[model samples]
Target chain A: MIERFQYDNRIVKNFLFVTIMWGVVGMLVGLTAAIQLVVPSWNFADWGSFGRLRPLHTNAVIFAFVGNAIFAGAYYSLQRLLKARMYSDMLGKIHFWGWQLIIVSAVITLPLGMTTGKEYAELEWPIDIAITLIWVVFGINMMGTIIKRRERHLYVAIWFYIATWVTVAMLHIVNSIELPISMTKSYSWYAGVQDALVQWWYGHNAVAFFLTTPFLGLMYYFLPKAANRPVYSYKLSIIHFWSLIFLYIWAGPHHLLYSALPEWAQSLGTVFSIMLIAPSWGGMLNGLLTLRGAWDRVREDPVLKFFVVAVTCYGMATLEGPLLSLKSINAIAHFTDWIIAHVHIGGIGWNGFMIFGMVYWLVPRMYGTKLHSVKLANAHFWLGTLGIILYAVPLYFAGFFQSLMWKQFTPDGFLMYPNFLGHTAGDQDGLRTARYRR
Target chain B: MDTLLEIKTAYVLRVIGGSVYLTGAFLMVYNVRKTVISGKLIANEDAEAPPLEKMDQAKESGHWHRWIERRPIQMLVISLIVVGIGGVLEIVPTFLVKTNIPTISSVKPYTPLELHGRDIYVREGCYTCHSQMVRPFRSETERYGEYAKAGEFVYDHPFQWGSKRTGPDLLRVGGKYPDSWHYYHMYDPTSMSPGSLMPPYMHMFEDLLDTTTTKRKIEAMRTMGVPYAADFPAHANDHLSAQQDKIVASLKKDGIEAQKEMEIIAVIAYLQRVGTDIKAKEVVEAKPANP
Candidate 1:
């Protein structure tokens, strides 16, 4: 017998709207931080200095902007994929409000310089506890839905979601084991080289699970829906999902190249990072190939345009990631702005464009109307594309130029451009130009 | 290329790029708002689907992947194990194996005042801009000092081998300048190095050091396996105060009147201690023979 139920578009709408709102606030902060680099005077107050603002900007964009977008897409797609409503409405509300509270606390604390000093994991001990509790609530809500799922076999998208939830929980708990000295301050339980290993293991996977995996899940669901075509291959997606997650965990040590990290671990990182391109491209190919006969629609459809570019950027950034992990190349690019350029390719290009496409596709459908203006969306696409180019290209040049200058030696064996400021000063035009286009 | 000219040109272009991106962001906000306003929200949409079947696993057979997909808990557990393997293999060795991190006999733990200074460094998020690890490269060794070693950082609670160098590496910044130089530099970076991008930390000179937690900090570090003496926490503040007084006296000798209570004194103490242990001639000579 067929059962009657209603899909929770209310929760989906709530999450999507919050995603867009936070995206603006996060990007504005990011723009401010970028500008602070060129005009040091803009870091006018202690609370707004580049050091403080940098963490705030990163956290806002990653956790607030991307984080909300993930929840929005997950809620919208998970119900349909499972053919069921969410397990509990109360749990959904708690997850939403609790997450926002965490973001708000971050906005307050980071600028005030209350941090544990770990990159991306900077929230202090109290906030860390809050995060752990909220994450468990999210887990219970998700698992409860799965147990009562109306669908017999879990779709490939749900597979990605399951992996994401499990892996992120493990990574968080292991990395956040700190010895607290006060309400606001704590030292990492692991120290020195041990600490570096754990932090990057967490850091790199945060990018993988938090940024890459959930978005891939969304891509699997939304891309097919928007294009009105089935995914290119279900088998390829299965291979892609398993290999990608397994390979990603070992690649964290690439970030610690040439540092005091053990040599064998670095080799493991290099090997696994290179192996990752296979699965990464497998997913990329699947996304792009889904649009094969739909190429004509891509030109006129702004949603398709955003998706195509998002997939292409994923391909480029994934390839660049592995290449950079190579020892010789990493030797040049590791500490340079090259790494920054590479990240933005993924950040603005892959993640940002994907979120934009998903939002445009979902908003009109949920509201029961055609888009108010497809023209405006197309314009946003062009402007966003140009902004990414202007942002990344010059930084790539600057990174290479700066690395060369740093390594340059005079005929007399003395260092050329020995003053560190000279390299940054040299890149000023590139950086300044990129800032405006952003 | 003239480096100075390029710097100025890049600065101008960055502002323009920022403007373009800002415009896109506004356009997005405008578009989404209009879409929301013109259309009514559908909070719930009607749907019908057959209830999931209760399958007989012993009788029904299919692909291997499908079995796990039907069991969410099992899938979650298997995923946990798959992802767990790498972190365990990489991290367990570094922790359990003694030789993964060698200990430098000459290296010593930070003093009470320097430890507080390090805490202040962390509190300010200085690691965002300055790196504490100097890699083994000719350019870095020439620019900063010696290459960093794992053992040198044994007492570091969380390693400050920062990823970026917006200013420069500070691993070997200790003992390179007088207490007065750090004093002025913290107050205003441009006073020491012209065209510097580092912001002036004027607030450090005014904020009082919170010495109340010095004992607790010492005790905590001991628990983390730092070799601080068992009775050290009781006298930690006295040691901190005595170090602060010496730093104040040195600042006075350089014609700068600094109070012992200021947070800058601790910062100065920490800065003066970085990389100084292994810098001694005997330590440098003793290095290769031990390991």
Candidate 2:
């Protein structure tokens, strides 16, 4: 009665390559955007301006790079965990090529100024449709594999993957509903406050479903395997999974606090966001404790080192997310680089590092050869860690500075930085002069 | 027996928590090692062992078990519960709390032309960069004049309330500028305010305003509970013409000449209407003293 099958590692390998390539590209764009903030004139020209390219950089990294990486890891890990081959390799390829096409389209369209102007969901209707189709292909492929899985009693990671797939589908479909005035332009089906609600609901959860959950799934699978241990607690995994999913959705309204969203909704967002800390840290604790009695191994292994740092960063980001969701704290942090720093902690440290570790582990097995160089990987690891610190620390200072200056009042009760332009550009010239001296 | 029981209980919890945590951690590390230690990844030789083979057989036998299959549905129901509860909590209050938004007597809905102009503004992604809602904070009051109340936006179909403050709030810009000033500003933002970051809307002047959708838009607004007169759409053109005449006369009074058809004329009308209702609450005209 035994059934055995071979997983298509090739599709996973393809996705892994895309993840690395896009990761580098996305980070470069992010670095460029960061520089543009300090030196506004760097890419101030019409086509290359920060406004046009910011979306490009974000989409490139989030969707093109990190997104593909998530798919690669998920598919490869899921099949092995379930003791099955993928349900459809053809569907997998279609999903892969379709996603890449969408990324290409975004790269071209956003710079051309053909945007609906929603953050994260910036692609116009056509590209949005393409994303939807490709997403469905991925869903079908994933669901098909699950249906044919040899394992009963789906693992905690599979639960997360299911939630991610369903929730992302719901968020994308709901938020992308627009009445097109042109091929490239459209109005949201829900306008005004309703639109704001829907957009943030999708936006915040996009981080949750698209960014957080799948990565958590990856962590669950790869972490135990790396440390050569069974999962620490099955019951806690169940609790963490359900609690995180439930609390995460309501936390979206926190992004709209003190804005036009109803006060009650904002309050709901705050309450749920505060509640999120329990489950979030539960998962983080789960991740870290998996390495119990392996501290020595961690010191010797760059993979374990990356993972340790990644989980710790996850803990930091989850804690900061709830704190930032608080109205009082958000007053200072909202729209500032503090939010940027917080996000990168997750992006670079948690998601980026974890993915890097995953790729390092996966590539060798697939290639049927020893790694080309452990030293190179260690170098990449150190450089990446340094890059994250260099990128985030300055932004933290900048965010704090911005908040203080914006709120600063003159002796006569006028704003100390009254002119918005002046406030944004304050001391730029001086900074530039100092840079030149250096 | 008690000491053994206590130690056993503690050990159990620690193992549970620790194993879960370790599993999470190990997976991430394994991923890295798998990539770094490039060599023939020896597949688990035990993966083909007899006990695992039996477990795999048992798994296949019950793989389609209904209870096992229902997990995704259960997860879906839970997801729905979370999102649904939040939605109801948010929607119920905005619906029930009529007293939360006290009405201003002078606050009226936008006329057809003004509504069209507002749509145009939204189309150009102005709200992405500019905010219209003023918070109750002291800084907001001093900068934008008069804090915004929920009632002010009651008639707004999709509230134009913005999230970011990259540009100043436009809540109180009504009647603050002459029509000619708006004309020049929209045509070329730098012409009016030096170093203004707002993009010019020069195309507004050349693009013929699409009034064809005006009736439909008004009808949609009316359906959303705005108290437009039943004949409002039928007389929409008449009202638009009258509004344009009033705007042109006001412009001339300020030594500004403008044709009624100019896009600036409509945008001026929209801007001039901002924060006018709040003026009735205070006897003091809240004008910039230096302007």
Top TM-score prediction, candidate number: 1
The sequence of per-residue lDDT tens digits that candidate 2 reaches over residues A1-438 is 555456687788778877876766666665555454434445544455556677777788788877997899888887887777778889989998888889888888876666666678878899988888998999888878767666655787888888888788878888887766557656566544566677788878888888889989999999888888777877678788878887888888888788766777889899999999999999998999889888789876777778888989899999999999989998887765577678878877898888878877777767677566666666666656666665566556656666666676777777665544443234332232324324
TM-score, chain A only, candidate 1, equals: 0.96
lDDT of 1 by residue, A186-279 (tens): 9999999999999999999999999999999999999999999999998898899999999999999999988888999989999999999999
Identify the runs in model 1 with alpha carbons over 4 angstroms from their true place.
A423-438, B1-15, B57-62, B281-291
Top candidate (DockQ): 1
How accurate is chain B of model 1, given as a TM-score from 0 to 1?
0.91
Q: Candidate 1, residue B79: CA error in Å?
A: 0.7
Give the per-residue Cα lDDT of candidate 1 at A41. Answer: 81
Off by over 4 Å in 2: A28-32, A39-49, A112-114, A126-130, A422-438, B1-73, B91-129, B154-160, B174-291
How does each model score on TM-score?
Answer: 0.95, 0.78
